[model samples]
Target: PAFTLESLDGVPVSLEGLRGRPVVLNFWASWCGPCREEAPMFRELSARQGSGDGLAVVGILFQETNEQSARDFIREYALAYPNLKDPRIDTGVEYGVSGIPETVFIDAEGVVQHMDRGGLTRERLNVGLEKIGVPAL
Candidate 1:
């Protein structure tokens, strides 16, 4: 029921594995225009902070057609971050997601620090990362 989604490369990724690291769990749908617009920014932030210091960004695709569709979206956006297909919307419901483009910031201790609904900008993400002690790029 917790965050457990396979990465594009077929790696098993779970929220538990991201413990002791600051995580940004973003819920998105390929059909959502706002999600499409903000996805690139999220990808950039994830790539910039992916390595050392345990800054993790995991994407959950909501209402996706299938794994291939999700994979295609990742490729289309050139998203380098790990993504999981949340077809049943289980993760979304657990996080109280009301709609697409909901971003939740989880701290190193796995506590939910901030929740943002709708599109996000690089500036907002930087502030959220700072709040979680992950440092901005």
Candidate 2:
């Protein structure tokens, strides 16, 4: 799904902007416990790839009202990846997200390789990563 949402810093982020790299779309909310659970894993994955050059781990805020809470979540998780605001749940509906924490792995060609609802485990995460051309963790 294509979308253009503002970043925490109020910069626009679009799926089209990240064309050639694999993307992990994480749909989450600051109030969600499970979203918090998988945050560090996403953080580490993005960090290992190094600063927007490799795999793109993008967070799409879901059902969240307060921007400050989202900011706090990023700060607490030490997330280096871009997190987009979706106050109207536009991206969530586009991605068919029924739950707070939904993960979608899209390949370099913008094809969705895998999708999972709820929190992530290393095993399940590896399965998705493999589809996006990353080796098993």
Candidate 3:
């Protein structure tokens, strides 16, 4: 179930490309209520984490209608991280995401450290960050 999904802006993003870093892979949809609720928190965490220091916040758009919808969602939330489109949903299947707003924390060694199946708060996100060997937001 390995994938190299393209970002809204057409940038290629892959797990292999982000090998050395701890990854926060969030599966969400524009139309999902819980996903909307946690979008801002994800944005804040992405801003705080940036793309340096061996950490990455990657948004995997699931069950989204179109690229424009995903782009609009990202713009509305002011998200700085890459939002990748999982059209076939194979990536989501591999991650066992049964619903929107699921999150997977992958450690530096490419191990799945934590899996959360709902909207995330700053506190819960901090715990996941800690589990993946990163500083809390």
Candidate 4:
């Protein structure tokens, strides 16, 4: 599903705007333990967003009532990707999210390539990226 959610600072992050690149769309909540565990790995991958990989990492805050907590989490993790606001979890609903930490990988053509639920590991994340045609780095 296509969507445009605003960052904590109100900057719009649109799925369609990230065309021509593979996308990593993560749905997570600040209070989630699994989300916390994967934040740093995501932070690392976020740095590769605009490189030759032409990949984009984006986060959709799911079921998080406190915007400040989300902001603090981003700050603490030093995440480089765009973390968008989804106060009502609307985007999650569209994606059939039954739990936090669900990640969807989209190809350069904007086609959904893979989906992973629960925690993400380096191996699993690499596998997902592989499906989207991202090379090992």
Candidate 5:
């Protein structure tokens, strides 16, 4: 199921809002070290494509951190993209997220195109973006 959540500033965001753009929905936990390591890559990707056509990166903070912690993480990383708080883990379960740092690539039509179940390197991210027709920066 497609999911929706609120950003730190209470903006409503949903998979539908991302339609017509390739989206990378990442499930992560604040306590996961691997998640921490891969976060910068996601941040960079989002920043690079934020103003580009047909590309978006939505970070889903899984059932791990409070709103304050999630906001703190975003600030610390200087992440410019929107981050969603999935406190109930419903979105994670819907996306079959079994662990931290899992990423799902959704195409322009909101179809799940690819799933990466572990840490994401720059190369992996580029490959996924390329697959989804999002030009790598």
Candidate 6:
């Protein structure tokens, strides 16, 4: 299932727009402790994979009420990737997200490779990248 959502900057980001590249769709919330713990790893991976022909890191904010709080969280973490706000949480439901800090890896062909539940370390993320037909970071 394809979905479109607005980034924190109000720009539209669609899963369809990212079909040609491997994608890391991470579901998280501002208040989640695990989400905070894994944010640095996500930031590092996003930086490494953000350039040419690299993976796309897309963060989906879940169960968040304050948009400003989400914005602040992004700034505090110095996240350089796209973060989509899922206020109504329709996207989360579509993705079968049951908890915070869940991660879904999608390949270039838009096929899901893995669904990780809980905070992710760099090592785990690398494994998922490999599963999605991308080189380990």
Per-residue lDDT of candidate 1, residues 11-64 (tens digit): 789989888888888888777788888888877777767467678888888777
Tell me how far the alpha carbon of residue 57 in candidate 6 is from the true structure, in angstroms, after superposition. 0.4
Candidate 5 lDDT over residue span 17-64, tens digit each: 778988888887767788889888887788767476668888888877
User: Predictions ranked by TM-score, top down?
Assistant: 4, 2, 6, 3, 5, 1
Global Cα RMSD, each model:
2.0, 1.6, 1.5, 1.0, 1.5, 1.2
lDDT values of the candidates? 0.81, 0.89, 0.87, 0.91, 0.81, 0.90
- Shift in Å, residue 136, candidate 6: 1.9
**TM-score of structure candidate 1:** 0.87
> Which candidate leads the pack in TM-score?
4
Distance from true location, Cα of 58 in model 2, Å: 0.4
Provide the global lDDT of candidate 5 against the true structure.
0.81
Residue 71 in candidate 1, Cα distance off native in Å: 2.1
Best by lDDT: 4
Model 4, residue 119: distance off in Å is 0.4
Estimate candidate 6's alpha-carbon lDDT, on a 0 to 1 scale. Answer: 0.90
Candidate 6 lDDT by residue in tens digits, 11-119: 9999999989999999998888999999998888888775665699999999987888888889999999999988799999999999888999999999999999999
Residue 43's lDDT in candidate 1 = 74
The C-alpha TM-scores of every prediction are 0.87, 0.94, 0.93, 0.96, 0.91, 0.94
Model 3 per-residue lDDT at 57: 88
| lDDT, residue 66, model 5 | 65
Q: In model 4, which regions exceed 4 Å deviation?
A: none
Name the regions of candidate 2 deviating beyond 4 angstroms. 51-53
